[model samples]
Structures are given as C-alpha cells and as structure tokens.
Target: MRGYVAMTAQEVAEFMASGLFDVSDVYAPTSQFIVDHQDLDDEEIEYTLSMVAAEDALEMKTATSGAACVLAFEVPAESISESHDMSISLSSPLKWESLECLFEVSSDGEELTWYATQEIDANLASWLK
Candidate 1:
C-alpha cells in the first residue's frame, strides 16, 4: 500500500531525531525482555518488575541485571486508582540497536475508565411500551 513507503537514509535520521520510538515491550508477559537501552541501577530493575507484579500483570520470568540470573518480585498496587501509564527503569545499561521482533499481549488485568453520552426520549419509549 502507499502507506508503506520505504524511508531513505536522511529520512531515517530525521525520524530518529523526532522521537519515533517507545521501548516499553521489554516488560511483556510473552517475551524475554531486557531493560534500559542504556546502563542503569539494580534498583531500577526491581522497580520495573514490582510495578508489573503489583498490578498482577504477567511476565515471562524474573527480572535480572547485567548478570544472567533469574529474578522474582511482588506486584505493586498503589498507582492504579490514579491513572498513570506504568514504567520501569533498567538496572544496568544495555547497548542493543535493533530488535528482531517484539512480543505482545492484551489482558483484562487492569480496568480503565471511559465515559460517553447517548440520547433517548422517556416519553416516546413509555408510549411505545
């Protein structure tokens, strides 16, 4: 389709400068994700998972730092009642440029609020009934 035109080299550079990425998939249930495209602190990793677990959201396994060790955590619940998009910081910086594929998932783990309006006529409905 016309929507899928390939980008030229200059176009790629421009896109990068325009903040065209959101790397949030590193904390998904179906994928083995690594945190922080850059180096980070151990506490940051813990904070990421704790946010997920506190929400009762699922992940593949434990979160770890530079080492290949498995990690576990308890979920966080404090921020939900308030509408905030959750995020985690990485323990150590990682320097990977491109990813092959990202895993995805959608669950009813948390409820979001929405509101809308509709029109009706009570008198007309009552007469029809």
Candidate 2:
C-alpha cells in the first residue's frame, strides 16, 4: 500500500545515508478519508490527503524544532494496520526498499514541492545549503 509519513529533513538525510527508514505513524487513504472527500477523484483525493498530512508534519516538526518534510512510499499491504481514528500505524520499521516520493512543506498555505526518490539527495543538499 502507498502511504505518507511525516519526517524531519535530518531523518531523510539519515535514511538516504543508511538505506533504512522507519516510522510508527503513516497516513493513508482510509475509508473515512474517502467519505470525507467525496467530491474529488481518486488521484485528487490522494493528493489532498497527502498535503493535509504534510501540513500536520510541519506542525509536529515545529513542536520538536526541525525542518519538516513528508515522504510518500509504498509498503506491503499487510504491514499497515488502520487505527480507529483516521491515521494508520505500521507493524514495524521499513527499510529504504520502497520509497517513491518526497515533499517539502516549509509552511502553511504554501504550495508543496514534490521530489522523486531519485531527486531527493540533490534537493535536500540544495535545501540544506
């Protein structure tokens, strides 16, 4: 399944350096999310949800003090378990085997810029410099 994770820029760099990635929380397109966003097409819904998750990630980073980013990755379907709420949790930490995309959410209301997995390192380097 495809999911979005909230990650710090440091975390992203570490994952790239070490080839490992793990996080307890992931946001996905749950049934409730579909119901809440009935007006959008499937692609639109997914994009909308991803942006919402990205915004939330920024808030989390603010509380902890770091640069916030969102990672879009594909994981085994069985690895994820949906919670009673809208979010989902992973069974275990994931390796770098399935990352697909990345997003930079610098602040609220700004458009998010997406980066492909292959483009991440260069983008991160530029962002850091």
Candidate 3:
C-alpha cells in the first residue's frame, strides 16, 4: 500500500541518516477513505488524502517550530491497519527501502512540491542548513 507520512525537516534528516522511518500514524487509502471518495479514482483519492495529511503536518510544524514535509512510501498491504477514525496505523516502522517520494508542503499550506527519492538527501541538506 502507498501511504503518506508527515515529518519535520529535522526528522527527515534523521530518517535519512538512520535509513528508517517510524511513525505511529500514517495517512493511507483505507476502506473508509475509498468509501468517502467514491467520486474519484484511486490516484485522485490518494492525492486528496495526502493534501489533508499535509495540512495536519503544517499544524504540527507550527506547534513544534520546525519545517514540515510529507513522505510518500510503498509498504506491504498487510503492514497497515485502519483506525477508528479516518487515519491508519502501521504495524511497524517503515524502512527507507519503502520510500517512494517526498513532498515539501508550502508554508502557506496551499501547495505541495514533490521531491524524488534521489533528490531527498540534497533537499534535506539545504533545508537543515
């Protein structure tokens, strides 16, 4: 399953160094998500969910005083379990091996600029310093 994870820029740097990404909550396309977005196709639904997650991440950034970004990853279907609410939880930490892409959420919360896997390290280097 493809999922989105919100993290601070510092967190992104740490994950890059450790080669592991662990978060209790990840936003993914769950059964409830699909049911909620019956009008859209799979790809569109994923994008919509990602934007919502990005907004939450932006709030986290403000509360924590750090830069916020969203990560796109691919994990096994069995790894994800739905929560009572709209979000889902991962059975275990997702590894860098599953990473697919990254999104830098704009400060104004109006845009999400994508970063490919190969570009992430350099982007973090610039953002952190």
- Per-residue alpha-carbon lDDT of model 3 for 12-90, expressed as tens digits? 8888889987787788777787887789898898888789878877877854445778888897777776553456788
TM-score for each prediction? 0.19, 0.82, 0.88
Which candidate model has the greater TM-score, 1 or 3?
3
Misplaced by over 4 Å in model 2 are 62-66, 83-85
What is the C-alpha lDDT profile of model 1 across 13-75, one tens digit per residue?
333355243222223221123322224354554444434542432232123211111112111
Best by TM-score: 3
Candidate 2 lDDT tens digits, 1-129:
678887777778888888877678677777777787789888997687678777777777744344678888887777776552456788877777789888888666367788888898777765443
Worst 10 residues of 2 by lDDT: 58-67
RMSD of each: 21.1, 2.5, 2.1
What is the RMSD of candidate 1?
21.1
How big is the positional error of residue 78 in model 2, measured in Å on the Cα after superposition?
1.8
Alpha carbon lDDT of residue 129, candidate 1? Answer: 25
* Predicted model with the maximum lDDT: 3
Model 1 Cα shift for residue 100 (angstroms):
34
